[model samples]
Structures are given as C-alpha cells and as structure tokens.
Target: MKKMLIVFLIFAFSLSAKEVPSSGEMMFDLIPIRPLGLAALAIGSGFFVLSIPIGLLSADPRQTLEQSARRLVIYPLHFTFQRPVGEFYGYMEEIEYVSD
Candidate 1:
C-alpha cells in the first residue's frame, strides 16, 4: 500500500507540472527602438510642448482658467519667492492662484 501510494503521489505531481513554451513561441514580440525612432519621439514631444501655449492663447477664458487650476494642483509647491536684488532675506511663497 505504501509503494502504491508513493507511485500515485508521483503521478499526481507529474500531472500537475506545467511545460513552458520556448521564447520563439511567445505571443508578443518586442522590437528595439533605433536612433531615428528616438529622434522622432523627441521631435514629437517638443511639438506637443510648443503647442500648449498656442492652444491656451486660442482657447476660451474658462478653458484657460481650468488649465491653470489643474496646473496649480499638479505642482502645488513649485515656485519660491526670492529677494530681487538688495533684500536681506529669502522667503518661500505659495505660487498658486485659486478662483471661486
């Protein structure tokens, strides 16, 4: 009975074992980005940044206000107030403008 039980357990463990497929058999393929691809990405990012101000200027006042509010919330503690030229001390300032 002990030998039979050990054989059964071995068979059960073997049945539960899973076989992984080779890398070539993977469903998704990863492609490396070339230098040209990176350059294109940089150019696209620059264009996106340049377009924001143009869009803001062309957009309505309400949209601009909403955008400004969103920016303030995203960068809550960004700006600091420094003495311009002849002041003795520097101070940290909350640079956000909240609207009603």
Candidate 2:
C-alpha cells in the first residue's frame, strides 16, 4: 500500500507539470508597450503638482522635483517604448528582471 501511494503521488506530480511555451508564444507575450507607456506618462504628468511640497522640503528643490518627475513620467515611458520587445535591458531592467 505504501509503495502504491508513493507511485500515485509521483504520477500526480508529473501530471501537474506544464510544458513550456513555444518561441512564438514567448515572442507574442513581449510586444512593445507604446500605447500603455504614453498613457502612463500622461497620468504621471498630472501628479507633478503633488510632488512640489516634497520637493521644496528637500535640500535641492528643483533637482529633487526634476528627479521625481523623471522617475514618474520620463523613465517609465522611455523604457516601455524603447526597450527590447522581449528582454529587460535598460534603466529599469534590474527591477523587472529580478521581479519576473
């Protein structure tokens, strides 16, 4: 009975293993994000006003604000539109690669 149970458990585990996607499927999943990026940029631009006070409190007000704006608006849009369609390779690459 113990041997039969072990065999059954192994068989169940094997059945749960899924095959990997084909090259085409993988490629399809990596399409460029031009539209999405543009939208995020617009949304982030609207939030710039919210960062003003935080920026003012920092030692370098203008630069702090600029950095925040770049992170919130510029970088996301740039990476989304310009990056390799299927790979993480630029500024945000480390965060993305590690997360995925």
Candidate 3:
C-alpha cells in the first residue's frame, strides 16, 4: 500500500513538473480581424436560404434530360431504359442511357 502510494506521488510530481506555459504566454498577442470568415458565413447562409426555393423549383431528372436533348442535341438521353443482357450490374447501374 505504501509502495503504491509512493509510486503514485512520484508519477504525479513528475507530470506536474513538466513545462506548462502561463495563460499570458499561451494567449494570442494579436487577434485576427476575420473579415473572410464573416464573409464566408454570410455567403453560406444566403446559399442555404436560396437552396430551399431552388430545390422546389428544380425539374425532375427525366424531364430535364428530355428537355435538354430536345433543345440542343441529335439524341436525348432517357432515364427509363432497362439494362442490356449479360452486362455487369455495377458497371451501368447509375448511368443515364440514351436510345440510339
């Protein structure tokens, strides 16, 4: 019991003796103006507010793809197509396919 107490005291004293800076030394001498940080926060908040209406106004993927193809392309990509036989599942699972 005494041996354990002596070991604990020695360990505690050794830890406390390590060089720890005073609060004055650890504190920043010059604080940042942070204009950029404030600007970023403002812009992010604006975008968050903007996204709520934009998301509601956004068209469905199938309709958007169809419209884009009709307005500006030789062929339009369709999202409602099925997979070709013997193709790997992972290879084409997430791609938008166009009928040629």
Candidate 4:
C-alpha cells in the first residue's frame, strides 16, 4: 500500500509539473505579473537605498551591500525585465549575476 501510494504521488506530481508555459500563462504574466514585479522593484530599490548605511556597518560591508542589492534590486529587475515571459521557474531559484 505504501509503495503504491508513493508511486501514485510521484506520478501525480510529475503530471502536474509545468515546464512549458501555456498561452494563458504568457498572457497572465505579461498583463499582471510584470506590472507587479515592476512595482516591487521600485519599492525594493527604495529599501535598498535606506539600507545602505546599515549595511555599511556590517563586518563584511561589501558582501552585505551586494547581497542586499541583489535581493532587493537585481532579482526584481530580472523578474520584471530580464526573465522570459511566463517562465516562473526562476522565481523560486537563487539568481546569480554572471559577469562576462
């Protein structure tokens, strides 16, 4: 029974997982998610500015500031502008900035 339950759970999870976005998801992302992300970006930028002095006081000031900026500003910017339309996978993952 346990084995069957586990197998059923795995099958159900796999079937419900969406790797590709449908047209409806694309439309929803464009119409609503993007705008909300933009708003969040703006708010986060403001908070980032306010955190600068406090961040500077940290032992590892540079790392602290960079982390704050990445979380508050960069992630939102990526979600709002850089991310592909309707791709929600990046939302839950850590974003790393790769410099060329």
Off by over 4 Å in 2: 1-33, 89-91, 94-100
Quality of model 3 by C-alpha lDDT: 0.42
Regarding TM-score, does 1 or 4 come out ahead? Answer: 4
Candidate 2 C-alpha error for residue 97, in Å: 19
The local lDDT score (0 to 100) that residue 22 gets in candidate 1 is 49
Which of 2 and 3 is ahead in TM-score? Answer: 2
| Predicted candidate 4 versus true structure: per-residue lDDT over 20-96, tens digit per residue | 88899999999999999999999999999999999999999999998899899998998899888888864648566
> 20-98 in candidate 2: lDDT tens per residue?
6666654653544455667778888778768888789999997898778778876777666655454544566544322
Q: What TM-score against the true fold does each predicted structure earn?
A: 0.25, 0.47, 0.31, 0.73
Ranking of predictions according to lDDT: 4, 2, 1, 3
Supply the global lDDT for candidate 1.
0.44
Best by TM-score: 4
The candidate that achieves the highest lDDT relative to the unseen native structure: 4
For candidate 3, lDDT tens digit of each residue in 43-72? 555554555554456667555544444323
Candidate that beats the other on lDDT, 1 or 2, i.e. the better one: 2
For 73-100, candidate 1 gives per-residue lDDT tens digits of: 2232222122122222222243345757
Per-model CA lDDT versus the true structure: 0.44, 0.68, 0.42, 0.89
In candidate 3, what residue range of length 10 has the lowest lDDT sum? 74-83
- 3 or 4, greater by TM-score: 4
Off by over 4 Å in 4: 1-20, 90-94
The segments of candidate 1 whose C-alpha lies over 4 angstroms from its true place after superposition are 1-33, 60-100
Error of 1 at 2 (Å): 36
